[model samples]
Target: MSTSSGFSFPGRWRATFHQRDLAVFQRVADRHWPGAEPVLPRLSRSANHGLLWFGAAAGMAALGSSARSRRAALRGIASLAVASAAINTVGKGAVRRERPIVDLVPVMRQLKRQPFTTSFPSGHAASAAAFATGVALESKGWGAVVAPVAAAVAASRVYTGVHYPSDVVAGAALGIGAAFALRGVVPTRGQLPPPGRPPADAPALTAGEDLVVVVNRESGSATAAAAVIRDALPLASTVECAPADLPGCLEKAARQGKALGVCGGDGTVNMAAAVAATHGVPLAVFPGGTLNHFAYDLGIETVHDTVTALTSGDAVRVDLGRFRPGPQGPEGADGYFLNAFSLGVYPELVRTRERWAPRIGGWPAGVLAAFEALRGSRPLTAEVQGRERPLWLLFVGNGLFRRVGPAPGRRHNLADGLLDVRAVHGGRTPGLRLLAAAIAGPLTRSPVHAAVRRRKVRLSGLTPGTPYAYDGEVASSGTELTIDKLPEALTVYCPMPA
Candidate 1:
C-alpha cells in the first residue's frame, strides 16, 4: 500500500487517532468530577454564542484602572472575532466531523440542546483560548487571571460529550495562532518604540535626587503611583495636592527642583510642561491618570520608565504645541498644549464631561457628555488661515498623528515640528460627520472630513465666548487665534534603548 507520499495506511492512522480521541472523551464523560457536574455544563452553555467572553471583555474595560487594561480587552475581543471567523468559514467546513456519541456519557453531563452545526472543531474552545491569549499578550497579569477560566471552558466541551479530545485541542491551537496573527497585523504598544531624536543632554540623577514629583490626589491610581515613586526613587520629593492646586504646586516644584516630575493626566502634564519650560528643567512623567496620553506617547507608562531614564540621564527635546491669547487673553500671553487642541463639539463635550465627572465618574460622564454635547449642536463658523468655513470640529496636534486603528491617533515622531490639523466638514448630522472623520483618519479628503499638516495655522471669526479645548481642558476662544509649534522646546525624560 506504499504510495508516492510513502504512506502505508492512512485510513488506519486516522482510525487509530479517532479511537484514542473517543476513549479520552468517554473517560471524561464517565468520570465523577467534583463540582464540575453543576458548573461545567452551564459554563459550556454560557459560551455558546461567545456571550461569556464578550461580557468578560466588557468587565475588563469598565473596571480595569488603566488604558493597558482597556487595550487588552479590545485585543482580546479582536482575537476572539478572528478565531470565530476562522472556525465558521474555514476550519469547520475543512473537516466536517460529526459530534461524538454520548452513549456512555452520563445524562446530567449532556447538553440540554445539542449543537446542530458540524462539530469538527469546538468554536467555544477557540474563542476562549483566543481571548485569553490576546489579553495576555498585552497584559500578563490579566492573562494569568483569565487562563484558568479559558482552560476550563475548553475542557468542558469534552467533559460534556459534545467534542472529541482531538477537536478541543485543535481548536485551542487555532485560537492561540489567531491571536498571534492579529498581533502581527496590529502591533502592540510595546512593539513600537518612542520617537528618537539623538538623545539630548540631561543630569543623571541617581536615586532621583533633586527631582520633585507632584501627584494629583484625584488622578486615577494616584495612591499606587505615589507608592511606586516613593519606593523606586526614594530620594525624590513628592507633593500631593488637589487638582485645583496642581498649577501652583508644579510651578513651585519646577522652580525648586533640578527636574520637575508630574503624575497625572494630559491636562496635568500640560501645566507641568508650561512651568518646566519656563524654569528650564527636565520633566519626568509618571502615568497616574486616566488616558495619560502624553506619558504613553513619551514611552513612559509607569514610574519605572521615568526612573530608568532618570538614572541614565536619557532625555529628549520635544515640540510643544502653542496657541496665542493663552488662558488670559492678554497681550503677549500664550498657552502650550502637549497633546492636542480642538475647536467645535469636542470642546463642548470636554466641558460637559468635566462638569458632571465629579458627580457620576469619568467614563459615565464621558458617555453622558457625548450625548449632551451633540444633541442639537450646529456647526461652528470660523475663518481658517484666510478663508471662512463651517466646521464641526478642527483638531490641531503638536505633531503629525497617525491613526492606529479607527480613532484617537498617535504620534510616532513628537518633534516633527508640524501641526497635525484635521477638520470635520459641516453637515446636517454633525455626529455622523465626526464619526466619518475619525474612521477616515489622517489621509482622508472627503466632503465629511479633511486633514492637513502645516508649520502654523491662523483661525478667527469665532463668536464671543466660543469655547475651545486643549489637552482635555476647555477655554474660551479669542476673536483671532494663532496655533503653531515650538520645536524642541521642552526636555522630557524617557527610556534609552537597551
Candidate 2:
C-alpha cells in the first residue's frame, strides 16, 4: 500500500523500520526511558513545556515593549505556530501512516486521551521540534534544552505507539521547513536580513573551476558545513557525493582541472587534499572534522562563521607530512598525511573511535575511544632519535595542528618553520593523568605527554599497523615508516592575525 493511503499500523511501522531503521531507533530511545505506556502523554507534556516557555518569552518582550521587542516576540511565536500546524496537519494529511498501537503488537496502555486523528506523521513530535527550534533561534541557551526535548518528544511517539518512525521524521522536516519559511514574519532583529554585498574584493570563481561538495551524509557536522558552503557559493554548482564517491569525484575534478571544495570530516579532508596534491590543484580546506586539528592549525574558529573569511581570505603555502614505508618485501608503499602522523595509543584510540563516529558524534566518540585505549594495551616501542626509549604514540604535525585565530594581537603563523610533534608512551595511569592535564590547559609543564618540534623522524618495531593514523584516516599495516615535512607545498585561505 502507498504511504499516502495509510497502511495498517503494523505494516507502516514495519515499512518505516525497514526503510529508516525505526526499530533500531526504538531500541536507542528505550535506553532513556522508564518504559511507560502512552509515550505520547510524556511527549505532550514537552509541548506544554513549550507553551510555558513562549509565555515567558512574551513576558520578557512585554517588559521592554519596544517596537523591536514586540515584533521579534510576535515573529518568534508565529514561526512556532505555523511550523506546529504544518507538522500536525499538512504533513500528516499528505503522508498518511498509522500508529504502531493501532495494528502492531499491542502494548497495554491506559488511554487517558487519544490524539485527535489518524497518526501518520507525529504532530506532537513536529510541534515540539518547531517550537523548540523557533525558541532556539531566539536564544541559544534555551535551544540547547529545547533541541534535546524535541528529539525526545519524537522518540516518545514511537515508544507510545502513537506514530510510526517515518511519521516523526517527516513531521520534523515539515516543521523545520515551516519555521524557515516564517522567518520573514518579523522585520529585522528577530528575522534575518537580506544578504548584504560580498566584500568588494571577493574573488570571482575562477573560470572553468566547477564546485564539487563531497559529503558523508551520515556525518552530522558535515550536514551543517555543506549548508554553509552552498549558501556562500550560491553561483557554484553543489554536488553532494557520498564518502565512497569522494575519491572518484576528486579524480574526476582533477581530470577536468577544476577546484573542488570538500565538505566533510577529517577523513574527507585528507582524501580531498591527497587528490588535489596529486593533481597539483589549489585545494581549499573547510574544517568539518570533529577534532579539526587541521582547521585549528590553520586558525579557523567555527565552520559556519568562517564563510566571509574563507571567501575573502588569502592563499598561503603550508607544509604536508608524507609517510614512506620501508621495504618489507613490498615494491610500492607510500602514503601522505596532511595533519599529524602517529602510532601507539593515539592511533589505536582513533581506529577504535572512527568505527563508532557515525552513531555517536566526534566528541563522544573521542571520549569512548579514550576509554577503550585505557582498557586495551600499554605503550609500544616507538623509536625516535631525539626522543627517549619506546613511546606509546608518536605525532608529527605539519603546522596544521595549531593555526592562529583572529583574536587581537594573535597570529596563526602557518609558515612558522616548525611542526608540532608529540609522543605518548606513558603507562595507563600516566596516560589518564596526561589526559587530565590536557584538559587543564597548555602542556608547557606536563611530563607524561611530551610535545616537541621536529623536521624528520624514523620508526621500526612500533611501526604503522593496527592502531595507527595519518591525518584523521586510520589503517593497519606492517612496514618501517618514514616521516618528513614538505614546507610550503599547498595554499589555503585563512584570516590574517588581528
Candidate achieving the largest TM-score: 1
lDDT for 491 in candidate 2 is 58
- Colliding pairs, model 2: 296-403, 297-400, 297-402, 297-403, 392-424, 392-425, 393-424, 404-412
Q: How do the residues 329-392 of candidate 2 rate in per-residue lDDT, one tens digit apiece?
A: 2546566676667777777787777788768966688999988887776767655663446556
Whole-model lDDT, candidate 2?
0.57
Off by over 4 Å in 2: 1-209, 301-313, 326-333, 359-362, 386-388, 400-411, 436-449, 463-466
**What C-alpha lDDT values do all the predictions have?**
0.87, 0.57
Query: What TM-score does candidate 1 get on C-alpha atoms?
Result: 0.91
Q: Residues 1-498, candidate 1, lDDT per residue (tens digit)?
A: 111212123677776777777777767877789999999999999998889999999999887766778989999999999999999999888877777776667898889899887776889999999999999999998999889999999999988888888888989999999999998888877776556555678899999899999999888777678888999999999999999899889988998889999988788888999999888999998888888888878777677888999999999989999999798789889999999999999998998888999999998999999998789688899999989999989999888787565556568888999998999988789888888888887856998888989899999898978899999989897788899988999999999766
| The best candidate in terms of lDDT | 1
Error of 1 at 342 (Å): 0.7
Error of 2 at 56 (Å): 15
RMSD of each: 4.2, 18.0
RMSD of 2: 18.0
